[model samples]
Target: MAPSIRLSPAARSLFDEPLAIAVQGLGPRQQVTLRTSLRDETGELFQASARYQAGDDGRLDLARCPALPGGSFSGLEPMGLLWALQPQKPFWRLVKRDVQSPFLLQLEVFEGHGERPGRLLAQAQHERAFLRDGVRRVPVREGRIRATLFLPPGEDTFPGIIDIHGFGGGLLEARASLLANHGFATLALAYYQFEDLPQKPKELHLEYFEEAVNYMLQHPQVKGPGVGLLGFSKGAEVSLAMAAFLKNIMAVASLNAPVAATCIPFSYKDKIIPAATSYEHKAKTTSSKFLDYSDVLDDPFQAPGNQSLIPLEKAEAQFLFIVGQDDHVVKSEYYATEVCKLMQAQGKGNFQILSYPGTGHCIDPPFFPLYPIGSHPVFHKRAVLGGELRAYSKAQVHAWSQVQAFFKKYL
Candidate 1:
């Protein structure tokens, strides 16, 4: 009998869900190479390979067998083939530009762990879909709101949540789609780098975000006394500003963003949250030839600089600060800690922080490969988004669960 690759369930599955992998009908104790390959919407190839041996029973279950070194990853990672995948192109991050489509994965088994695997004995294909079958993807084009709303299937109404991507711009619906699968009617909102919006806007206004919050609260499929905000990088900073001034905001989940308005100033109704002085002149060049932005943004704790700090004590929403300790892109952990002190001074305890050491910037949904470095979305220059792959992957999974639980409990 020929060896065959098998996926535990049907080939169709959510991008965030994990599937079992195994190779059957192989010779007892046979050494083989397992490779997984897939192309993003852009036609860029991403692939991973692992070496393993069948048990005495002639079955190789990834859940039971530990992967050997000298491959993409090693040890007992059942879903390593998916997460260990790296792009063939340099500095290319795997992004799901169109959530309406699925990423098809090709899995193959070969005879040995050579530069070229000896024989292609087994092959299987799987589709990692972004949009769930029952979930509805609706494009939002209300006044001043350029976004996509994702609602769970059926007559049931889900809690409302707003998801914002980084300063890099564009509407990223993948995260919102995943959250909608778990019963949150999420809106992936875009502020810039999108249709008719400027690529390099000088100022960010919270009024635009306020419109999104109101839109969510008023949505028929969305349930809310208030809505939650989930954001990354500059998006997180915007969330913080909205939380501070906007009404009916139940929670804010911030990922690796500044505590104070920086890079770009944020403006509300009448006043402005002044941003720290720019210090691009002070940025250090990393060994990888990318910029290390760890110290690029000025500190918010010092005098005059505190003028840019957001006063979250005025906010009615609970806060969840997810920090990556080794994040060279920004001082995430430091910001989280100082904010805690400031909140304590004001006698407010509406914030919960989850800090992960060795984790870097860019924490996406679970099982996605780690993006150690990429061009800064705002700068268009290569920058270090530091992290150890395994640690960052683990952080991504745990942080996602924590965020869901936080939203469920509070929002």
Candidate 2:
């Protein structure tokens, strides 16, 4: 009998790997009957399997084995039995498979984990929308890109919003979805996934975003010749950059996004720009990645001084900066102060900033619980784990209402 098999570290990292039972010390033409049983974390027997034959190589193929509940058996590569299990949820066990054998074989167990954080973060980045309502997709640039057209229920063309998503996250979020439901033509633009990934941050491409804005303005559903730009996190930074460089943009709203220029390597019209702007301590949690710009005004790689990239002073459109005071991911205070200063310097009056106290990053709309508060990587800078589940405050609601009013008048 072969020793019990276990998962290797590399295999474990892949998110999905099967559990197996190996049989050895057999001769050709020797038939070996095995009996197996599988159980979940509750210690209940979920599966019972019976037989297998020894191959010419003195190895038994147990591929096609019965799967326990919530588990699937496969004969695919890494040729072994597989069980689908969730660790955060429960545990499962596989029992003996050999018959007429005195030895009791115990298959090692593995659990299924919940969705990846990166995936969840991406999903949370976009608001959900119904197919029959609000917005529709139109092909652009030979279908290389798509233009989303948001239309109000009434025949009247409403103001348009060009939505941009954060870094490493794609379109399809609650922000745009809800905005479209509320009568705004929201175009969630995909600058990266619509085409190839850019080579670096300085080299990052904005041509697609620019085209998307043009497309929105030309759409019949749009009420005006231009549209507003609403961005979150990296998207917010992009919004700022676009407003700085693009003349057609009419308004901008930056939500809980970093004010610093990004550091992804990309080519901007054949120029090689280093990716050194966005920095995060991988060893730390999201809240622990809190950024402060007070010290780096002179550093080009830091915030504050990067203002040349964003003409906050020359912005012609109305601007709203929405941030959470307790947000650790991006220093809301730093961005608020810097943007206010820029607006003041430029004599720009059509701008406002609102901050929600006791709120963390990624403030959901009062449905979900407030997370990462007092944990290891707290953004609030306090050790208050599980601080209350304050998803949205009255102040946030008022601020949102104000946003709608502002856009209604400006967009």
Candidate 3:
């Protein structure tokens, strides 16, 4: 019989879940090349191939077989299939194409390469998840904070989260929706702008976010002694502050975020959290002639607001800070380090820090290519985001997994 390929989860696989691939019906000890490819929304094609030799039974099991030479990666990395792909443009670009859409991965095994190529050994296609099926997307509009809720499929309660976005306002549904697929009840909170909200970032009230926290705790789909906060950039600052100021926050995860409040003023019951000291320096312009703030970042200690850090000592929630050393928008590593130091100085032990080198400011979910340089979506200017593709990709994967594990353990 001809060789055939089979996938364990043959129908659909979650973005963060692994799939097992097995090849059977091959000649004893046959040699073959397994090729994987996918196309992005922009019609860019990415492909990767690794040579392999089947066992005496004419079967190749990805779980046990080590890939031979002639591919982007040399050995077995758990998620090698993702990073191993040769990009026509960049991995980040491919991920950006349509994060909300499913990705179809085409796989084929060929007997050989070049002109002496043998017959096709096996071939298969599988739908990989960015947003998995069975997830319930609910609109949140009951309180002061307007947000969207994502509940994992089924009636089982899950650890809850209040997700916050950065300077570019508007509820970023991608991250929360993706996390929900991984078994969390997530609320993507919109602070300013978007859907009958404030037109711009200004006079922000922390009460709105507090209301979001209350909403998450009260959600039937949410399992909570306390919920968690997942935030990026300015949202990260809010996460830190919320864990310190609010009640019932079991944990906080800040991604490439800031130490001080940013852009707009944050107030809760007449208490104000001042914005960071920001400096605007021109780097370059995008094709649309927008100025890029590649070289400029908030200058810590340059303003009185920087002195008013979130009281880490008061925060009872566990903390995880994911920092990119090469982040161009903020000194993420420095801020994360200082936060750790302050926490330690205050005898707080509930914090973990992971800093990745060669990574940039806007670190998204896993497998997304390194957008080392790009035009800011809101600022509308091109600038260096800072990250090498390989390191950034690896960081994204590790950070994403770590976050899920963290929530499972603490929330």
Model 3 has an lDDT value of 0.77
List per-prediction Cα lDDT, in the order shown: 0.88, 0.49, 0.77
Clashes of each: 0, 32, 2
**Candidate 2 lDDT tens digits, 1-411:** 532223232122111112344544455534433333334324554322223444566554454333223223222313222222112212221222211111112333221222211111000011111332424434345234554454557667878898777655334444554566667877766665445534223345556567777777777768776789888766887787777656788888877755545444333344332333433333243355433332222234244444324545666777888887766556655676676776787666877888776665554332222343332222223332221222343434555576677788887
Global fold similarity of model 3 (TM-score): 0.81
TM-score ranking, high to low = 1, 3, 2
Question: Which 10-residue span in candidate 2 carries the lowest summed lDDT?
Answer: 117-126
**Which one is best on TM-score?**
1
- Model 1: residue 244 alpha-carbon error in angstroms: 0.3
Indicate whether candidate 1 or candidate 3 has the larger TM-score: 1
Point out the higher-scoring one by lDDT: 1 or 2: 1
What would the TM-scores of all predictions be? 0.98, 0.56, 0.81
RMSD of 3: 4.2
lDDT tens readout by residue for model 1, 25-98: 99999999999999998899999999999999889999999999989999999989988889999878898989
Question: How well does model 2 score by local distance difference test?
Answer: 0.49
